[model samples]
Target: MIVFTLLGFMCATVVGIIRIRDLFSVVMLTGMFSLLGAAIYVVMDAVDVAFTEAAVGAGVSTVLMLGTLALTSREEKTTGSSRAVSGGLIALVTGVILIYGTLDMPSYGDPQSPIHNHVVPRYINQSPNEVGLPNVVTSVLASYRGYDTLGETFVIFTAAIGVIAIIGRGRRRRKKPEDQTEADT
Candidate 1:
């Protein structure tokens, strides 16, 4: 029930994002969508995932996008209807392919699922002795998935640097005009 409500809100947000020409409004709607996704994760008992979604999706990404908006136009430029149609078609095809790919997967929480039969048990039983951690979640993330976590951190850091570079470049361009005007004076 709660999940469905969140999903509905997410759908509405997506629609709003698509219809809005204002980039700032779109960014805010995207952040709201992320918050709704985090809420869904929380309701599903994946608190760690919820925290990551909230922090990265809603917090950091929103701030970076707003920073970008600061250096650019507030409204998105209109495109041809043909281009919009082609883009929509591509998105529809991609979504269909993704859904088809998921059809073969086991249903959620099926006991006979490979992860439940194998990986989950191993992590649950061996993590304590092998990793020597009091908390299973901490051991799994910090030990077993350490490399994956590190990769995620590096990706986020790289994205942040890229945004900072773009913003800095914009500032430099703005200042060059001022510098030239001062020289003229």
Candidate 2:
């Protein structure tokens, strides 16, 4: 119940951030949203994921956003309510559809599922010898399917570098003041 409540509040806060015409409120809501996501990850027992969420999403992201706020406008001008209504309606429909799909998913930790009886055992036994590697996943990734995974990893690294470069201090440029009085001499 607490998890659900926090999640609901988080979602509402994200919505508020999008709708409210106040810069302070938006920043606060964004922080709240990040913290709530961290909390949800904790509740789900994803400790590693929760740690990253708390650090990157809750901590670093808040600081980055606040720094951006300091660099930009503080007050947000109101754009009226019709756009809000349209956005809310679309989001509501999407959420309902996602919930319905989630309801059809198999229960977690069910060992009796077909996954246990499938071709996993064959792969587990033959993977190391067939691919000439100890770690099955590594063998599958680097030996049998190296190029595809390398491309995916390269893409992620490229994206991460792009984001970091964007946030990093750019080249310092100095512009000389215009010579106005010299022409009058």
Candidate 3:
């Protein structure tokens, strides 16, 4: 029930984001969507994912977007309807392809699923000895998937650096004229 409610809220938030021309309101709605996603994750017993979503999705992303907004317009410029139609078509097709791709996956919590049958038992039994970590989750993330985690971290760091660079460049550009006039005086 809670999950359904959260999903509904997320859908509504998406609609709000799409219909609203105010970039600030759109950013706020995006953050709300992320928070609702985190709540759904919590209800689904994925607390780690929930924490990550809340922190990265809602928290960091919102702040970054707000910083971006500060450097730009508050309201979004209206684009041509043709561009909107094309974009919507692309999104719809991509969503269909993604949904089709997931159709072959095992159902949630299926005991005979590949992960449960092969991966889970191995991790549960051997992680303590093989990885030397008492916590299976930690062992899996740190040892078994170390490279993947590192790659994700690297990507996030690079993105953050890029955003900071862009924002800083804008600030420098805005201040250059003032600095030049002061120097002349």
Compose the digit string of candidate 2's lDDT tens values, residues 43-84. Answer: 876666678788888788788778888978888766566677
lDDT order of candidates, top first: 1, 3, 2
Q: Give the TM-score of candidate 1.
A: 0.83
Model 3, 1-185: lDDT tens digits are 77788889989999999899999999999999999999999998778889999999999999989988997889877874668878989999999999999999998667788877877899989998899977787888989999999998999899889977976688889899999999999
Clashing pairs in 1: none
Model 3, C-alpha of 49: deviation from truth (Å): 1.4
Tens digit per residue, CA lDDT, model 1, 58-118: 9988997998899778988787466887898999999999999989999975778776786
Model 1: ten consecutive residues of lowest lDDT: 76-85
How many pairs of residues in model 1 come into backbone collision? 0
Query: Which candidate do you rate higher for TM-score, 2 or 3?
Result: 3
Q: CA lDDT of each candidate?
A: 0.90, 0.76, 0.89
Q: What's the distance in Å from true for residue 13, model 2?
A: 2.8
**Weakest 10 consecutive residues of candidate 2 by summed lDDT:** 169-178
Q: Which has the greatest TM-score?
A: 1
Q: How far is candidate 3 from the true structure (C-alpha RMSD, Å)?
A: 2.9
Rank list by TM-score: 1, 3, 2
Off by over 4 Å in 2: 107-185
